[model samples]
Each structure stands twice: as structure tokens, then as C-alpha cells.
Target: MWSPWRIVGESLLSVAFGLLGAGLAALDHGGTVRIAAAGLAIAALSLLRRTLPASVLLVTAVGSVLFGGLAPLVLVAAWSAGRRIDGVGRAVGTFALAYVLNLGMAVVQALPHLSLPRLVFGVLWPLVAIIVPGLAGRYRSQHHTLTDTLREYEAQQQRERAMIAGQARARERQRIAQDMHDSLGHQLVLISVHAGALEVDRELTGRQREAVGVLREASVAAMHELREVVQVMRDSTEAPHEDRTTPGVAAAAAAAAEDTTALSRGVAGIEGLVGTSRSVGAAVKLRHSGEPCPLPPTADHAAYRIVQEGLTNAHKHAPGAPITVELRYEPDSLVVEVANGPATRTTDNGRGVVSGGQGLTGLGERTRLIGGLAHAGPTADGGFRLAGVLPYTSPEGGIPSPEPGNVTTTFVDPTNTFWQQTPGDSLDEGAPVMNGNGLKELAKAMSRKNGSGIAIGCGMAVLISLLLVIAALGVGGYFLLNKAEEARIEPKQYDTVKVGQPEAEIRKQLPKENSFVTDGLETDAPPVPKGAKCLSLTSTESSNNPDMEPVFRFCFKDGKLTEKKSFEVRN
Candidate 1:
């Protein structure tokens, strides 16, 4: 779309017309013809948008005005540049360049019209043009910087999240390796050591020797595989690749895929895992217990890994054990279960091989990562059993598929985890709720147990607030009782006072006891008897309670003392 030849042609045309206009404007002592030519050049330059850029457009617009090239060109160039680019960087760059060029030209043009006041407006107006866009461009620059900073911060957060995830995965793998070495390594050593001693005994028959040899081979293979895994982990990135087998669930799954990146093949690829076990003298039979259904991606991965690890452990620990793996697909999840019986006596191995016991732990980690559950341990009836339940997500991305038209909606308890349910199990409410979110529920249960202390403290605080409120109410009640007792005049005089009388007039109506030798009982002597008031009763008689000191009381007209009979005893 952007042709170099077309761009060159546009530039040459623009330069030619601009020079021609300059010649006409110089010869005619004016610029009417030049203005017309510049307008024509601008129109042609605009037509070359996809091919040519603002180089031609700038020149074309400026040449259109003889002495006033500054304003016309800057304005037109800004308008043209807006339609040229989408990015802020380019737009600001174009605007800034135009501002500088326009302001400089304006100064040159105004030099000839130099009067003190005229030059001021001339320079100031052009400064406005230059500064306005420059200020706008500054804001654009700061805003662009902020956007870039935010994007960088987001990318940094993603990297940190990935790093934390990787670290957690690595730690899990290390723990798995340690468990394998500790538990399963000792078993394999016993098999190898006892078999080597039995091989030396002369009482062994030929068939017995062959079985022992197979046992030794299987044990050594498992030990070496475990060793290779440990070495690979010791310095993960640089470990030798010569003995690399399927490292984890993901690698095993990928090795079994025709195209590992594609999600369609799924658990079907686990046949490859079965083939690996059969080579190691283990017979692994894969079967389906229930009618299979379309499985969610999480269910698919969990099913594959559970079966693969079960078979792997069978081959490593119980070489001649007949292992059976059953998978069942349900509406909400997929269930995978693997069981192996005790070693058979057909070939009569000296001792069964047993490697590190990380198979079960690794399987558990894989299940938990995708909201699934896994269990693996020795079975009550001889060999071992492995089970996992993987919850499904809707392909539409949010909710699960609705119950089928023919099917009744049933809820299952999460903790009731079963790879395949028995025919006797009635689909009921919350039966599987415990097992489905067992890990999460375990954490919540612990938190609830721990928060009992905080709950007690909260109860204590509430109790203290209640006690304070009761104490404050008791204090208020005592104050109210004192006020009522002080206001006990004769019952007939209780309603005598009107409500609207002033406190000063009520005080004057009460009696007081005073030994008025000179002026008044007030501490401050006034020009007049300012503190004096006529009283219906003496202050001493008004204080009827002997326990109370003599105090002033202000009485109402009929006889009620409207003011308190409280003491003014000075120390």
C-alpha cells in the first residue's frame, strides 16, 4: 500500500509547485497566483496519504500563504496529521514540529511591522499558538509515560506470578523426590539385596534364577530412573538429557501425544503409558466401569495422570502384579481408579522390585492443581489402590452444563470421593461435597478452629460495653431521684407554677436565710442591692432536710419552689 515511487513523486511535485509559487510571488510583488497554486498543491498532497506523509503536506500548506505561511500551514498540518497516525507519539511529534515552525515564521513576518505595542501582540499571539499545543503535547507525553509504566508493571506482575508458581511446583517436586527416596528406595534395596543373596545359593532352580534376574533388572531400572530424576532436579536446567524419561504428568501426557499441544487426544494417549509398563514385565489392563461421557479438560488430564502413575508404581514395586485401571465419566466429573493384586507365582520372582514412593505424592499434587482429589495407599486386601476425582468446567467457560432432560438433578457431598460409584449409590444431596473441595475445606476448618480465641475476645468486649451502659444508666437514675426528691413540695402546690416563667423571677419568689447586717449576702458589693430578692419563705426553712445545708430556693406564685433547693456552701 505504501509505494516508494509514489511517495517520491509526491515530494517532487510538492517541491516544484512551491518553488514556482515563490517565483510568482517575487515577480508579481503580491501572492494571489501563488496562493491559488499552494491550495492546488495541498489538495494533491492530501490525495497521497497512504503513499506520502506530512513532508509534502507541510510544504504544500505553508507555500499557499505568501507572508502568512505560518498560521495556515500549522493549522492545516495539524488537521492532516490527525488523520495520518493512530499513535500518540507520532501525533505529538507532528504537532510539536508544526508549533515550532509556525512560531518561528510568525516572528520573522512580524519583524517588519515593529511598533512597541504591535510587536507585543504579534509575538504574544504566536507564542499562544506555540505554547498551547506544546502544553497539550506535554500532557500527552506524561499520559503516554503513565500508560507505558502501567503496562510494564502488569508484565512484571505476570512474571512474578509465573515465578512463584514455578517455585511452588519445584518445591512440590522436591518433596515428592524425597518421599520416593525415603519410603520406596529402602524397599527396592531390600529386593535387590535379598535377590542377590538368593542367586548365590546353589539350591535355586533355573526358572527361579530367571525370575530373580527379572526382579533384579526391574529393581535396578527403577533405582536408576529415580537417580536420574534426582540428578535432573539437582540442577534442573542443565541436567543431562541422556536418561530423561517422562518427568511428570505433563511430560508423560506429552510423550503420549501425537501432537502434545493439541487438547483433543487427551486420556486416549495414556495407552503409551501402558505400553511402557508392559515392557517392564507388568500386565496393566485398562477398562471403563460406567458409560463414558464427554469429559472436561481438567477431568481428562486427571484421569490420564492417575492411571499412568498407578501403572508406573505397579511396574516399579510389584513387577508381576496384575494391575486393573477403571475410568468412569460422569456429568460433573471423571473418576479414575487403579488396583493391583499381590504378586503371582507363575514365573516366581526372587523378590519384587520397589522404587521411591513419590508416585502417589506426585499424583496428589497434579490433582490438587486443577481442583481435583487423589488417594493412593496400600489396600486392605493385599496390593495397592489409587483413586482420583476430577471436577469439570464448562467449555463455554463459566457454568457447568445443565442436567440432562431425562436426568434428575442431584447434589453430591464433596468429601465422598469415589472414582467409580457403585450401582447401589443413589445420587443424593451433597454426598460428594466433602471430597470435591476437601483440601480447601480442610483449610477453612482449621481457620474456624483457630478463630475461637478471637470469638471469645469479641464476646468479652461486648460484655464490657453492656456493663458500661448499665453503670451510666444507674448514675442517671440516681441524679433523677435526687431532683425528684428536691422538688417534693406539698401535693396541693405541685401545679401552681406556669411553665413560661424566667429562672430569675423563680429565684426571686423563693425564700432565703440571711443575717443581713449591712447591704447583701453577695461576696461582691454592688452600687445597688443587685443580689437581693423578696422571698415568700426563709432559705433556712426551705432546706427542710436536716442532712442538707441551708440553701436558696425560688418559689412560684401559688407556692411551688421552681428552682432547686441546692447548697452554695463555700470552703
Candidate 2:
């Protein structure tokens, strides 16, 4: 309401009015104090009109009545007060006061010379000044309120649109996570099982057994980490760290991070990653510097994911390129960099790698979650580089000490019944144990489980159908009753009847017996005059008590109709 632009504009307008008034007054009586006083009053009114509208209006009106050159400032203050005041009561009161002051001043100043016309003009001018501008100001205020309401409504719709988009994205991610858990998790578990069996074989040599052990450990860890990744993807909380200071949030986050790190501890897989790349027939090198220090689980997971995503990009986008993996453990942070030289040979399959750029976007989001920085771009030597730096401290703040009763551990004994090594439970003995009858029984059980759901769905459908049918029948019955009531006719045909027409023809012109007319007309006549042949034309019949009465009497003498008359027939 009192923005800088508004203040500046009002001030300029006020000054202009003040200067014009002072110039006109100087032509009549050249007074310096009058000019200065008028200008000061106008400027103050303009500046404080929005903040202290009532006070400004009252002051400016009084000053205008007392001084010669400040009357226009009253107009400006009155207009502004009209807009600022909530209702017309205050505005009307202030305007009335100003009108009285102006009128009294005019009468006092020119009483000896004032005529009736002049007096009326002086009184009306003050009313015009107050009413016209005040109405305009009220209109402007209403328009402004309407504009603000529309803007707020548009902003609310925009927020709802953004929320819907976010919800759709969340649902899609949940679906992908569920698919990964159902499909990939089962495969990894099978691999872990087979590796465990191979690691325990007695015929294998020591070196062969060592390789199997690494494979088994890697398989088990991979499975454990996969579950953690799925859980994180399915989680609805966008900012996991914002709740770290809450009672159990830190512990939950720490547990999730530890589960993610089950495959390898911090900085444990740099050499193995390079070895795998070299084994794939790519020129790869690993470099390390500084002393490795322990990192919080969140940071550790971030560092591992960064290197893993970098190597994956290299393998997919630049196959057979020489890649360099660098690790630097600074006093405050751990920096990891993976850079790949230009590809010496690219396979057809490598060119077909589908990259929608979500990988890098996801990597960036993950790094930021742990208070780390990640960068990926093309190198100057026609190569690509991916790099990241992770702080050892917790992402929320400094590392939080586990509080009492807030620690949660999922480290169950490996020899528990869930993972026990029962004898004769090898893959050969445990595989494909279900026979035909067992399969049939399993199918029956599944059908039984689904039957209740199907029955409930059908019952709901039937209920809805019955309700719709009942509504349709009620609507049909209403229309039918209305149609039957509308069948009753008025005696428009009676107007066509003539005095000398045949009695049989007049009887044919009348409505049938069961039909009724609105006019209380009788179909049967009183006993015809003497022995003259009589014919009665019916008009209406009572449905409730048909024998009660007929009021209309259409009479015919001899064979031809002679006259038509009616008499009231009461029960």
C-alpha cells in the first residue's frame, strides 16, 4: 500500500498541485509565508496519506480552510482516505467535517459580498470535491483487491500442479524399486547360495578356495546393499537429513547407510574396481595418496556410489578407454576422481548404450545429500571425467554421537536359523522339490486367496446396479403418474356444440366416461321436461366417488338438441 513508487508519485503530484495553487495566490497577494506553508502542508499530507490517512485528511482539510493555496491537497487526502478506510462510514464522516469547515470559512470570508447563487456554489463545490474522488478511490481499491485474489488463486493452482507432478514421479520410482527388489534381488540371493556352496568344497585348492571366498563375500554384500538401495528409492521423504535432530532419524539414517556399505567399507574397493576394468581388456590404472581415515556411513556410501557410477559410465560410454582412478584423503575431506582417455576401440553394443542423463542427475542428488560435491564432464583431450569430494563428518552437521536408547543394529548372527547350514540341503537335493500334486495344491491355495477379493468386487458391483435400478424405477413411476394426471381435459369441445345440432352428434363430441374436466360440469341431466325425449351430454366424472354428482346439464328436446344448461348435483 505504501511502496516507494507510490510515495514518489504522490509526492510529485502533491508538489505540482501546491506550486500551481501558490502561483495563482501570488497573482492576487504576493505573500512568501503563505506559499511556503501551503507547500509544506501538501507534501506532508501526500507522504503520510497511506500510513495515517484519517489524520492527514483532517489536517489537510483544516489547513485548506485556513490557508488560501492548500485546498487541492484536501482533495488528494480525501481520495486516499477513501481507499484506506475499510467502510464508507469513516470516509463519509471525514468528508462531512471537511465540507462544514470549508463552508464556514467561505461564509466568513465573503459574507458582505456573498449572493444566494454564490453561497450555493461554494457549498456544492466542497461536496463535489469529496464525493467524486472518494467514489473513484473506492473503485480502485476494490479492483486492487480483486487482482490480488486472482494472483493468489493462480499461485495455489501452480502449487497443486507441482505437487501432482512430484507425486507421479514418486510413484514411478516406487514401481522401479519394487521391480528391482522382486527380480534382481532373487537372482543375487541365488548367486550367494551357489558361491557359499563352492567356498566350502574340500577338493578345491587353497588359491581356488580363496577366489570363491571373495566371490561369496562379494555376492552376499551385493545382495545386502541392493535391498538398502531399493528401500531408499521407495522411501517418500525427499530430505532425509532435515530430520536428523529428531529422536530416531539419525539412527535410521545411519542404519540405512551401513546397509548400503555392506558390500565394502570406506575406500575398500578402489583397487578391485580397477582390476575388474583391466580384466575386461581395458587399460586402467589406480592411484592413491594421503592416509585413509574413517568416514561417517553416509559419506562412505556417497564416495562408493560416486566411483561406482563413474566406472559404470566409462564402461558403457567409452569402452576400451584408459581410465585413471584417483583417491585423495585430505584432512577435512575425501576426494575421488575417475577420468577416462579417448576410446581406442568402441563396440557396437557400447554405442547402443541408453543414456537419458538420469544417472548423472541421480549422482548429483546423492552427493548433495551427503554434503559432498560431484562433477562429470568432457575432458580437453576428447575424454570424459567424473569427480566427487565427500566430507568425513555427517551431512546434517558434525558427526552425531549415538544417543542412549537411539541405537538400532541389524547385525544378526550368521549362524541363525534363517541362514543355517542344514545337512543334505545342497542345491541338488533342495532344487525342484515340488511334484504335480504339490503344484496343484499350491494353485488351489492361490485361487482360494483370490476368491474372496473377487467376491467382494462382484458384490460391490451388484449393489451399485441395484441402487441404479431403484432410482430408474422411481423416475419412471413419477413420469407415468404425471402423464396420467395430464390426460384430464377441459371442455374446449363444448364451444363447438350448437343449439340445433343432433343430440347423437353432440354426445359423440363429448369426452368418454372415465375422463374428467376441470370445470364442475354435469354429464347427466335432471328429469327432462314432461315426456319429451331427452339426451344428456357428459362433461366430467369424479374418480374418487363417481356416483356423487355431475354439475353440467346438456339437454336435447325431441331428436335434435334444443338447449344446453347445467345444474349443480350434490350428494
Candidate 3:
């Protein structure tokens, strides 16, 4: 999966690391074999850092302990391991193992000349080379992951929003189709019934009777076509059977006919609906209560459909039953109810009045669209009731209101012994609550997956690194200042040293040996006396010229100071 440019870049980086490690080994006075080994190890580490970073890190850490020239490679390897590792546990474990190896080697190397400063440096050296670089790389990796996760989450949200909008549009179109089927189909059936009654009148001419028969046929045809269009508009699950007869058309046509009025779009139309049913020999009554309040056009239309559907169902299913239509206008809403008693006659009148079964469903949808609720079920006294609550003011943007009204009446079906509930009320109770809980659980899951522990670990690593840096600087500065003071001896102190003095006494009078200035002084200094040991020290007094410095030397033999010499050495 590596790109050509990335491969080229890695090759160049490997070569650079190899050359750099080799040069450092040469500068440290390593032999040819050691230099080559260091170069190859660094080159291998750079090449495999991405694919096998942990293995490369372990190898480099061991090399650093064995060869001082390869110490710098350990940091690079640790950084790579941190960045490439998948989880906190793996990255932390790998870095800890490397640190342990380096620390163990440092401890063994320093055991011969171990002091407080050397011990502290030994521990802190590995920490700086490993812990700090590892933490920084881990932080970088986590930041990149978090950023990518946020981008993907945003894109997913956008896609979900678009999908939801599309669903809303589809449901709206289905509602419109249902409205047409319920409202227009009812009016068309009434037209066919009235035309059928007129065609049988003996007072009309033969030609006029033919025209009325044609009109009735046309209305029936229109209803059939309307059903086809509504079925096409609906989803497959709700599509009605086209072959079933339209309810109330043939039965109402067979009953007595009466003068008809243009139906109102609101509560005022209930009287006309009842009158039509009465003409068809059904016992129906209309009752009104409270002062009528103005209603929005959508709510008004919904109220009318509820009554029409109720009357139609009653005429078709409960023949010879008495029906009542009630309209109560409350302070904020209009309540419409249609209740019918038990049937007195069976539906075997040879005029099939089978229900299409979508009337009440479409009525419910219409009521909900305009901030209303619909309910229909059998009553306690062997009867059925269809009821609805409509708000006086339509909701904004045609969206249903969460709470429709304060009216809380429950009707129980005698046969089923269950309460009839509105679709809006049931969905509000269950789906929203469940969806809210699901969203909360999803958020918690994401938080757990993203690893807050890694952030905490990185912070702890940074704090420890700072403390180690401060401790190392403090210890190093103390040793440096102490050594500078111990390495200098004054002119008076040097003069006080006597030749032939006991070595113990001479040592007490002289300052501590200055290893910094005297590390290889024997090779450049004048010849020493036979069977003698020498101690070298630098003078506190500076030479007048910058090119030279003064040094003091003492030789001991036979438990006495055998020789004392002072010289000016070139810088």
C-alpha cells in the first residue's frame, strides 16, 4: 500500500540514519567492525519502522545498550513504535520493555564506578530517550484518529438527515392521496345514490330516465378510477383491494332518497350528512354544545371527514341502527363524535355493502396532519363510536402538535376488552422514548471506543519527563561545580608541599586530583622518578597569556613525596 514517493522518502531516510550512525561510531573511536554494525542496525530500524515498529524498537534498544554510538537510534525507534501501534496497551508495553532493557544495561555498566550522580544519570538517560518521544508520538496518533472519527460521524449524520427528509416527503404524498380517496369518494357515492333514485321516478320522461341512469353509471365509474389512483399512491402494505365493492354506495342507493345540500367543509356539514343518512332510512341524530370557535381550514376539513367516515361506517355495518353525531367546541378545540347502537337487521339485503377498510385510517391520518387525534371502537352497550379532537388553530408547517388537547376520554371495546388509542398517542409513548435511549447508548459506546485512557497516559508521561529533566540538570550542575572547585590548587598551597614528606601528610596538604585536566598527563609530562606514583592538579592562578596554563605535579616513593614539579602547559 505504500506510495512510490513514500517508499523513496523512506529509502532516503534510511541512508541518512545509516551514515549518521556510522559517523558517530567513528568519532567515538570505534573499530571498523563496530562502525559497520552500528550503520546497518540504524538502517534496518529506519526501513522497518512502519511495518514492524515494535520489533525494530526492541532491536535498537538492545543495540543502544551494547554500543554507545547507537543511543540516538533508540529515540527514533520508540517514536515510530508509538505512532504505529494500534492501542494504548501495546504501545505502552513496548515502550516499557525497551526502557527496562536500557536501564538494566546502564546499571551493569555503571556498577564498577557507581556514584550518586552516575546512578541518577543512568536511570534518566533511558527515560529521556524513550518515554518523551513515545508520548509525543502517541499523542499525535490519537489526535489524527479523533479528527478522522469526527469527520466520519459528521458525514453519517448528514446522510441520515437526508434520508429522514426523503421519508417525510413520501409520507406527505401518501397522506394527500388518502385525503382524495376519502373526501372525493364519499361525495361521488352520494351523487350516484341520488342519480339512482331520480332514474326510478315514473314522472320523468323515458329520455330523462336514460340521462339519470347514465349519470349514475358515470359517478360509479369515477369512484372506481379514484380507487385505482389512490392505490397507486399508497405504499404496498396499505394498498387496498381494488375488486372489493365500495361501501355505502349500493345500499344507500336502494334506500329512500331526499333533497341534498352542498356539504360544508367543517362542523356545519354534520347536519347535512345526518339528513342524507336519515333519507336512507337510518335513524341518526345531531347534537351541538358550546359556542363555536373559528378553526383553521385544514382542521375544519379534518373535522368534516371524521363525521363523514363515521356515518358511512355506521350505514354499511350496522343497518337499522340509530346513530348520533355530536360536536362540542371547547376553548381551544372542537370535539366530533359519532356513535351508533347495535344493529337491528342483518346485512343480508342482497346489496353487498362490504367496507374497503381504509376510511377510518385515512380519517386518522387527516386529523393528525392538522394537529388533531382520531379514535374509533365499539362501545359498552353493543354499539360503535368514532371520535376526533381538532384544534382551532393549525400547527405551523402542517406538522402535528405533540399534545392535542386536554380531553382524556377512554372508550373500551366490549368484544376485545381493549382501549382504543390514537396512532399519534401510541407512537409518542413508545418510539420516541426508545429512540432517545438508543441514542444515549450509542454516544457512550463511542466514548469508550475512543480511549480516554491514552490521553491520561500521555499526560503522566509528560509530567514524569519534566521532573526527570529537572532532576538530571540539578545533579549534573552539582557535579560540574564541585569538580571545578576540587580541581584547582592555589600557589601558596603548592609551595607548602615539601619533598621527602610522608605521602599521607603531603596528600592532606594538596587539593583533590583534577581528572579533567590530568587524564593523560603522564604521557606529555617530564619523566617520573623510579618506583613512584604521581598526582596532577591544575593551578588556581591563570597565566598572563591565553596560550598557556600552569599545572602542579607530585611524585611519591617509599611512603614519601619524591618530587614536586610545576609546569606551564600549552592550551
Candidate 4:
């Protein structure tokens, strides 16, 4: 390629050569005329290149040969032509002739007596100078130009590739708009109808009623925004204005500027979410372990929609399983997790839920725009999980819209009273029919009853036995002196029955004076029955229940009471 740079360089040299030629013609000297003629010839030679093919370079080289061998431009042209000429033999042959002509002229000019040779010498030497070395320079210049041209061509190819890829992206966005119109547009219309019906129909079941209202609002909003996007694509306008006439997403956004209702229209209360799922027979639980809080309005709306979409998928796909929603707050990040166990029913439509099959992807995009991230997929244990992380910095360096209406949150009191039966929740077979509150109360009641029963049993058993022992000791002591005579005669036999025998038996050995036994139902004491027999004690009871009835039914057999009894609470 002949660049402007090359043109400028050659043009400057031509102008200089032309000026030199004119100046030399003004001087009155033979050498000056010769030199001036050479300069003019060189300048004209440079001009020929602009109009002729590169082959004209050979003609320029001839001019250099006729002028001085110092003509650099001629040398460059000769060399360029030589390199471009493909056959090596032709290049060498042509260059060799130019060398001989100029060499012969130089040889003649040097021989002072040889006039013929002198004339020949001047002409031939110049020819030689412009051809041989000129040819070498032309070859070098041609190689350099070719390398530079190839580099520029490569750069151009890369630019074209990038342009094509950009065009492809624009085309894909158009295609995506078309797909959304076909699928999401219709589904949202159905959803709005069902939802609108639920709002006015008092006879609708609660679950259906709640679901339809949310679905209706969400569908209408989604359809409106979708249509807006489609319209933008259809029109191919750069600076886009959203259409806000519809009661859909775009419209709600426009309304939220001055209305709180608009903000909550497509939003589900986070608290009611779990309850709704439970009402539909799903065993669901919700727990938030953090500062009691909420999010900015835009983030709230975006996140709530994501959660709604996720749960709707769970219900649509894994309808029978229990779900757990956990919201954990870290110092720098807010995490939302929705996990559901596998479904047991055959009707589960466990597939992608959105019409575009890009709802989650859209959620992710929304998250990114707000400096957040969202992750969603099926879990390994026949379940699904959706997670999102909303960051603090938004994409456009702005905060998400503030939430409308302050939250009036309530904290749970630990000691709140409760019941033995919960109206609804997880069912237990043998477990007490209670919530956490009932379990606490029942525990306290059982503890009280057990302590009382233990105290009564221990108190009664020990006291009666101690009284009998003391009476026997007293009677036996009185008999001890009398028994001294008996012991002297029967020492070994008395010792055998002393330590290991029952106290009742020991009491019987008290000469029948201190021995007392109770019989069933007929003790003489008012509280004790008479018939069978009775032992009366005048000592006050040490037990707290001093009004207790005496245990009258103790039967004795072979010097031991075989049956014993205690007071009964009722009659």
C-alpha cells in the first residue's frame, strides 16, 4: 500500500530536487548545468510514481542512473521493482546490465585521452548507480510495506468480527422479546382473571382465595411489564419510555411514587407466606434469626416476588412436601433460603414454571442490578432450594427505594400461657397434644404430683414403724430384769432370735403387753376398724395432712403383719 506518509516523503524530496535544478540553471557553470539537469530529471521522476503502476519504479531508476549515483529515490524504486519481479534470473540480469553501463561510463570519464570512452563513462556509471543498488532498496521497501499492510488488514478483520457479534446480540434480544409475548403474555392474563375473581367471590375457599389474589396481581403486573419490553423491541427505539397505562409491573412502579397500595399490590406479606403453605397441607416452618427487620421497597418487592415464584414452583412441582424458610443475616450480607422436601403425589408438575423459562434468570438480573446475587436449584434430598444475597451497593450507585409504611413488628414472649392441644401443626401419635407452651405446663403439674406422692409414702412408712419400735423397747426394757432369770437359763436360744428377726416378732416376745396389730375394717379407734384388731396411739401425727384416716387393714400371720395400708385421697 502507498500510504500518505510515503506520498509526503517522496513529494518533499521532489520539491527539493526541483528547486535545486532551477537554482543550478541560474548559475553559469558546466558542472552546475549538469547537476541542475540531473536535479530536474530526479524531481520529474518522483512525480511519475503517483499516476503509474509500481512498474514505473524501473523508469525512475533509469533517471537515477543518468543523474548522479547519489539519487536515493531512484535507488529505492529500482530495488522495489526488483523484489516485486518474481523470477530471480530476470532480476539479476536486468540489474547486472545497469551496473555495467554505469561502470563503463565511469571508466571512460577517468581516462583523460579517451574522449569516446569519457562520454560513455558519464552516462553508463549513472545508469549503473540507479539500477543495481536501487533494485536492492526496492526489494527491501516492498518487503516492509507488505508486512505493514498485512498487519492493518488483520486489525480490520477483528473489528468486523466484533461488529458481527454485536449485531447478533441485538438480534437475540429481539427474538427473546417475541418468545415472551407468546408465552408469558397469555399465562399472566389467565392468572389475572383467576386472581380478580377471588377478590370479589366470597364463597371461594381460603387457600384458593389467597393464592388467586396474589397470583392475579402478580400476573397482571408481570404481563404489563412484559408487554412493555416487547413493545420496545418491536419499535426499535433507543431512548425507551415504559408504557404505564396497564395495572401491571410498570404501572405499579409508576404508582408507587405516590401510593403505598401500589407497592404492596403484587407483594405477599412475609409472615403469611408460611401460614398459607401450611393451610394448603404443607408442613412448613419459618424462622428469622436476626434483628427484627425488613428491606428497602424495591429490594422487598424484588425479593418477595422471587420467593413467591420459588414457592409457587414448589407447590406446582413438589406439592406434598414440607418446607422450611430460613432467613439468616450476616454482617455484610442478607441471605434468603427456601427449602422443600420431596412431594409424594403424582400430580406434581415439577418443571420450569415461568413462560419464558427465565424467571430465575430474570431474578438474578434484578439482583445484580441492585448489587445482589440469587441461587436456586433442586436439592439432593428430593427437594428444592432457592437462595439470594442482596448487597449494599446498587449497580447505578443508588439505594433501593425505601419501603412504604413502617413495620409494626411484635416480639414473642417466652412465658406466654398455652394449652394442651394446638389447633393445627405437626401431629404426634403418643406425644402430648400441645405446643411448646402446653409441654411446659404439663411438666410442672406432673412434677408437683410426683413430689407429693413420694413425701406421703415416705413419711407414713417411717413414722409408724418408729413408734412400734419405741413401744417394744419400752416394754422389753421392763421385762429385761424379769427376763434376766429367763436369759440365764436360755442364753443361746435367746440370742438366736434377737438381731435378724422382724421387729414384729421381737414385739411378740414382749410378753404380749406392748405388741399391737391392726386388722381389716373393725378397729376400735374411730379411724381404725374393730374386727380384726387395732393398736391405738395418742401421739399427734408429724405429717402435714394430720386429718388423714388411719390405715386399719393390716393382717398379721405368724407374728408378722402381711398387709399394710395408707390414707386414700378420696373416701
Each model's TM-score, in the order given?
A: 0.32, 0.33, 0.66, 0.32
- C-alpha RMSD of candidate 4: 61.0
For candidate 1, the per-residue lDDT at 461 reads 46
Off by over 4 Å in 3: 236-269, 275-283, 287-306, 313-357, 360-464, 467-471, 488-501, 513-557, 562-571
- Taking the tens digit of each residue's C-alpha lDDT, what string does model 1 give over 1-571? 6489977776675565455544555554556766676545544554553344456434533433334433433343434444454576865575556545554555565454333433344334433333343334334444455556555644544443333234334444554454455335645654564555466557999999778777777877878887677656644632124212213222222222212343343578667666655554566788776666766564575577677667656645564678888777777777888899875532223344434445665567546545568988898778999899877663333112222331111132223212122222222221221122233443355436644444464456446545654655566556555443443334223234444466455444322222211112223222222342323212324445554333333433333333333233221
Q: Which digits, one per residue and each the tens of the lDDT, describe model 3 over residues 26-140?
A: 9877899989987887888788888999988888777787776567777887888878888779877888998888888877876654557666777888788887988888888
**Per-structure clash totals for the candidates:** 20, 4, 0, 21
Off by over 4 Å in 4: 1-105, 112-308, 318-334, 341-356, 360-375, 379-383, 389-571
Error of 4 at 217 (Å): 16
Off by over 4 Å in 2: 1-15, 30-52, 59-68, 85-89, 99-124, 141-168, 190-222, 231-571
lDDT of 1: 0.49
Q: Candidate 2, residues 80-130: lDDT per residue as tens digits?
A: 887897776877787677777778877786665454444655565566555
Best by TM-score: 3
If both were scored by TM-score, which would come out higher, candidate 2 or candidate 3?
Answer: 3
